[model samples]
Target: MTPPETQGQGSNAATPGASPAVSLCVSTLQHRPDFLRAASALRQGTGGFLLQARDRRDDSPATRVGFTASKKIGNAVARNRAKRRLREIARAVLPGMARPGWDYVLVAKPGVTTIRDFALLLADLQGALARIHKP
Candidate 1:
């Protein structure tokens, strides 16, 4: 599919000339201070509607993915791993399967995402998105 209009840096969809990739996952998220604002924007932009027959906000323009890792995961190294894992999942799963608009947030869970298998991480992301995107 064609890329969406660019609205500045906020426009993080896959670039046309570049190889296919999820420009950014959890598109609607911002710094923690902006979480409420981001959520509000996503809620409105996606039309306050959900698409999944499971009623999981499936019709929404952007699907949201969150990540959060606690201290037990390890020190900074571990945390980074978690973030990397989340990013990889975002990279692999979001480009083709996602609906037109989606907000994918990768919260850090100490060091979770970093340690997971690449294929499994990707599959997990797909499962999450599929549950919410349209049929």
Candidate 2:
């Protein structure tokens, strides 16, 4: 039996006059100062977590994001789980709404971040982002 052919699978199957999809560039924020600076900037709280954002005002054009879960969230395992959820939500939502040259931090809430519904967490992140970006 022959394998079925798929569209846009190989480089040789290029379509005429078609533009490739563009993906937003994003990077992870490291260093304590970056997180502190964002913490002191705009803040928006949602049911799932706290969102902090700051504009770097530099020439770089990539959005940076950081996730943090403190002891208040729980022990090591719980903290890790909370951070993982934050990272997933950021991955799903940040690409569409995050602004270039801005740094964002997602702070996990105790007893909330890990147990909240995934869809609601996503909505919370989206709402928080919208609030922080609003003038």
Candidate 3:
């Protein structure tokens, strides 16, 4: 029920010569044990949040990440917002800097993660990652 010319002109349609977007393959950590292990391994604190990382030392080559916001952040809505910010920062920064077979957890700060400037949050994550991976 659509004309040919308009059929392929949807917003998501790729341009004729534009290269496809390249997205890194990253996994989410869902197990409590995984988070606990990472917590016990390495920790880097930033103004926005706490970054915890652990090398799984397994055969898997995927980088896994987790986000957490405690009740101290506020009620449900505030906690969710903090976690959302953490997830976004992880998504943007982890792909390039995170090592394979590593698990990372981003814990939201009570007053920072939900309201901090986005660029600063990005820098915070990047710096934390650098310090964590340093020898």
| lDDT scores of the candidates, listed in order | 0.50, 0.91, 0.88
> How far does residue 110 in candidate 2 sit from its true spot (Å)?
0.3
RMSD of each: 13.6, 5.2, 3.7
Given candidate 3, what's the lDDT at residue 126?
Answer: 95
Clash statistics: count for each candidate: 27, 0, 0
In model 3, what lDDT does residue 25 have?
59
Write candidate 2's Cα lDDT for 1-135 as tens digits: 977678876666876885553348788888999999999999999999999999999999999999999999999999999999999999889989999999999999999999999999999999998888888
Candidate 3 accuracy as TM-score: 0.83
TM-score of each: 0.51, 0.82, 0.83
Best by lDDT: 2
lDDT, candidate 1, at 50? 18
The stretch of ten residues in a row with the least summed lDDT in candidate 3 is 17-26
Model 3 agreement with the true structure over 1-135: per-residue lDDT tens digits: 976666558886766986553346588889999889989998999999999898889998888999989899999999999988888888788878889888899999998889999999999999999998888
Clashes of 3: 0
Q: Could you give the candidate ranking by TM-score, starting with the highest? A: 3, 2, 1
Residues 1-135, model 1: lDDT tens digits: 967666654457555586655454335344664443334442211111111211234465555544445577678777667766665666666667765544445444333355556776666666655655536
Q: Cα miss at 53, model 3 (Å)?
A: 0.4
Off by over 4 Å in 2: 1-23
Would you list the clashing residue pairs of candidate 3? Answer: none
Of the pair 2 and 3, which is ahead by lDDT? 2
